[model samples]
Target chain A: MSKIIVQGVAQGTVLKTTSPINFLGAVDKKTGVIHDKKYDIFEKSVKDTVLVFPHGIGSSVGAYTIYSLKSNQSAPVAMICQKADLTVASGCALANIPMIVVSNEEFNSIQDGNQITIDTKSEKIFN
Target chain B: MELTSEENAALNGEHGDTLQTAYRILVATGEATNAEKLIPIKWAHLSGVNYNTIGDAGEQFLRELSKDARVKVKATVNPMGIDFDHISEFNHIDDEFIKKQASIRDSYIRMGVEPTFSCTPYDIFDLPEKNTQVSFAESNAAIFANSLGGLKTNKESAFSALASAITGKSPYSDLRKDDITTPMTIRMKMDNPNELDFGMLGFFAGKVGDTSVNISGVSQPNRRSCKALCGGMGTSGTCAKFQFIDSEDEKSEKVDFGKEEMNEVFDELNTAEKGDIITLGSPQLGLEELSDLSKMLKGKSFEKRCLIFCSRAVQEQARTLDYINEIERAGGEILSDCCTCLTPLIDTNETDAVTTNSIKGAYYLNNSTGVNVNLKPLTKIIEDETK
Candidate 1:
């Protein structure tokens, strides 16, 4: 089951990366490019897509990096994580980005390029 | 999460854009953390002041927020990129860096935040009552406030602390809750350990524990060692509070930290055989540390360049006590409102490595500043480096 951590409506194609994201190092704030070659989604753009990752791993400064992305018009439409840590939760709140938490099974089931819709009121994810 | 009528009004945009934004952040954080409601806080110590850390996006955000928002509670900030007073003394800081740094500070000041850029606000500012709730973003200060100051706070992020400052409210969860249970214990097997040893033990405990940990071994540590332990633990992991294991709580799950484990951590952080310069004060030294340093370096001078970081408040007190003259006589340059971690003052072209007692300093200097570290204790540094 996927729970809504931050309530909102977002529908878009998923950009799933199995590796956890550190907003400070893993993504570019200006271009929204996933430049961390260690991850599977290298060279991918997070703009306008539903970004999915395991969780955030980095300094608290990563929260500002997320807000910077939103200000620069390079932010994701929504975020899906297996767990919502303080860093990501605060960043999503600051940027007004919708955040959803899903089970490990559901996270693995959602593949890159998969299309989906999120509605926090009904607490459902439709594919 | 259930919010009070005032909180609801703030979220409903009845208050203003600033409060609406602040409440939105609070409610979202509360919902995420399973907090029941919002609780008022006495203070908020924020981070993200360093331009090198926050970048252009953060600067722009602050500039916009400063226009309409003022802190609802007492607020203080973390260190910026450079010591604004000593800009001409360092080679690494340029005009662009200074301009950006000034803008960040200005934004905070315009929002009614105090320009106390020290990370150790507990040393400089008048602390709130014991058990009173606050929000702190600096990791070391958060650890110290919870463990030593008897205050309640979660390890808040920069944005979360800023939100709390604007709203004077924090989510009632984590360390703020009164129902916190006794945590796992890490027993240190060393007898008569110094500050560096305590630092190693703290780093080990923070790595192993979750939210809180119990440490047993060192008893009645002075202020300097306590600060070192807090700095080391803050650098290692997310562990917030450390407690001494009470004699009645011997049945808890216990881990051991001995010489072997200490050497392992030392080997991990100590990457250099020697340092080009000696640096101190990762958490920024207080009056106590300054007095000790002064006594150690009474007539002797450093053989190489030595940079000491401290807060202007403590530095003034140390000057009144004649500690600053002794330090300066020993060829130590005292920089205020900044510390060794992530400061642009230490240019890689000027020096390759730093020798310090702080585990936090060693970690960041090596990882972020592209330098090596010789992790020696204060006693060892004074013995070998001073003549």
Candidate 2:
């Protein structure tokens, strides 16, 4: 798959969600499972996986939720979004989670449960 | 991003670990936004105070940050999860939740934050001089500082605002200059405009997305009207600052709105039925609003639960002015430093409906709490409650 450099790079199995997540309410802090009822990924565990989504929505406090995930040792190993806003950027920075944005075509090429390595240092994603 | 020698030293860890991390985050954010350099700021207002919203992870992060670093500039904080004085009143909030919330407050206090615990810092704090650069995180407050106060501040994230508070600097970028202030024009034509009309106008504007908008036709809005407008706009859209043109002036494409549009917005936001809880002060009530509410509540009693949330400073003033007595006498509760949307103080399951004067509160409470909310004017809510 074609690679892009948006933030940092890491590799994990993909956990995809179609809806934009508001991390503050969407994810359970202690369990790391998607709890927001609005999304199809409800009850899916994001722990240590490369969480993929379209983008982040809702409160800016979602940034802190991401940090809390790391503090609880329940954070996704990495993140990939179609677009990255301030909330996502701040969360990744604070949590030290590697994240990158990809084009729609590249994002479409990847599926849930796929093994992938996103490398920002080399500016590539290996599928 | 270009950094000065001092900035470089901080980034290089010569200054200290806290400064290094702060500067690094700022630099990264600046680079991401194509900011050429960082500018010094005199003030910073931070959000993300509620323990229910931030949870344990947020508490730990704040504790760690405060251990090594303190804010360099004068800073104020947003609301906590519960009112410290009225803790026993909110039985729905457990002791564990209270303890975690208190820790977050303590960390900010230890960091030398002003502990204002308010979203509407402009009402209590000294208004920044026009063009004064500041870093603010609360969307309503940030937009107010930018649009109404004539101050310059981009809508900051909680993390970025904390970073700016530590270093007293923010990346010099969007909404900081006058040259880039022009936005898509939204012309409002209202007949006999009142407080509710202003609120609906904001609700409509916010739905317009990230497009910078200039609102024309309304002139010289009072503090509460301005608050309602900004709060509604911030809730629905991402526009940070909106220009106000009192008189007709051709600058950009304009969308004219009238009373019909206002009713539509009111209809859309007011989803709950009568006899629901009446909530005020989503952005936290200002002094004038409290005074107005007190006047409306004189010789009147509420049939349903009415909660008025404001800052400690404002509450103190209201108490001194005997407004608190009037509100309490009328069977309304005054909650300070917390509101329904930020905290789990109110049990949503027990609450069948909610009537609020704040569009922001209605929107958030509906989504986060899963309670039916009716957005209405303060006058209407008071009248309904009294009747």
Candidate 3:
């Protein structure tokens, strides 16, 4: 019922990630390795901040990576995108994670490592 | 946002069962792009190899879907793979790729999709005529169809593309190709120029341009660079609809789209720094390409670590020759079937950094693998080996 503050809400279990295709969002659903190799959003770049960005950037194989993490039960609890491309969409669907897409500006408004919450049904984002 | 008559009818059970399945898929894409109505489609290129791999679950699902619905187009070719001992054009392929390749191929065949087995599907068949609406997959091929051939296709999924082809229409929206007027202008440049360096330049150009670029100023480049740029840009900006312009052609239609103008149009979403993993052969390779690499890599050793990958379809041939032996011997591992853009076959933590000559390879590696990738020329890779 509230919007997660860009800098303040960069915490809480990361239910959603908006990382662009370049800066990969990490969700080790298996061992719960929330740290990603793509750019260390949780570990270095944002340091476990609420992660947000555009849709995934790299391979459709991003689908498999998502699957691996999700199957291992280490994936983020939810996800939202400016647009849900195949890689993340497939993974979200397969893993049964809540995913939605909003405007790019709204995506940018989010800061790293902020505690975040999401309303998947309403497509409203909270930080 | 409202559904078109076709989409509305499908949702309301006006269309047949097949149309309904197609409708579900189209509606998902339509909602994403914020399209108002759906239009019928004539052809498509599929994405997603299978609903399930290693088992008949996918085959059964597709077989059931095929029973109720049929594609609308004259021909629909899914992304390519191999079932047997065929061409081996990829690089650094791993073991047991053939089994996975065959599993997916079996699923596609069961779902009634033709196994064209080439990333460049236009080579085998003519694209739907200019402005002929079709569903397509993969960013690079979509760009090639839109800009190079003038055929119209939105970056769609295997399901949506399949739905459009079956229903013979797609949802007409503001995002439709016909809706786009002129391509956006750019002013990007590569720091230095050399042979085989075109790949990296194209990649960066695509990234810089973001969706919908009319770029110029890629001087003295080649065909691979053009494709690489288109492909890489597609990766960076999923909705990128672009045309690499003829920079030197004063009378040409190609416009400028590059790094200089990137700040104007795009919001730098997430950034990467210098030097990372070196990847090759993202979208499956053919046998000849892999064979050539095997020859080039003969007796070569890497001073730095690199990940060499090949598509599973082409890897079959390489495996026959035991190509990985050369890579393992040369201090690198050959990944099969999987491309770096999707996910690292191995974990990213095991490696320090990366570098490569492929723009597509670099973009995926940089973004998906979390490795800062430096795209270099094949010649440079060779030089490093000799050193």
**DockQ values for all predictions?**
0.44, 0.35, 0.14
Q: Write the per-residue lDDT of candidate 2 for residues B49-163, one digit (tens) a residue.
A: 9998788878887888889888899999988878888878767778888899999999999999998988889988878788999988887888899888889987777787888
Please report how far candidate 3 places residue B223 from its true position, in Å: 2.0
Could you give candidate 1's per-residue lDDT for residues B334-364 as a string of tens digits?
9888888878898889888889999888877
Name the weakest run of 10 consecutive residues (lDDT summed) in model 1 chain B. B244-253
Instruction: Identify the candidate with maximal lDDT.
Output: 1
CA lDDT scores, all candidates in order = 0.85, 0.79, 0.52
lDDT of 3 by residue, B168-239 (tens): 766564335465754445544545544333443344445544445665555644444555555655555554
The reply for model 1, stretches above 4 Å from the true place, is A8-58, A72-83, A103-122, A125-127, B248-251
Backbone clash total, candidate 2: 0
Q: Is candidate 1 or candidate 2 better by TM-score?
A: 1
RMSD versus native structure for model 1: 3.2
- Residue B225, model 1, lDDT: 86
Model 1 reproduces a share of the real contacts of 0.45
DockQ of 2: 0.35
Chain B TM-score (model 2 vs. true structure): 0.94
For each candidate, give its TM-score against the true structure. Answer: 0.89, 0.88, 0.64
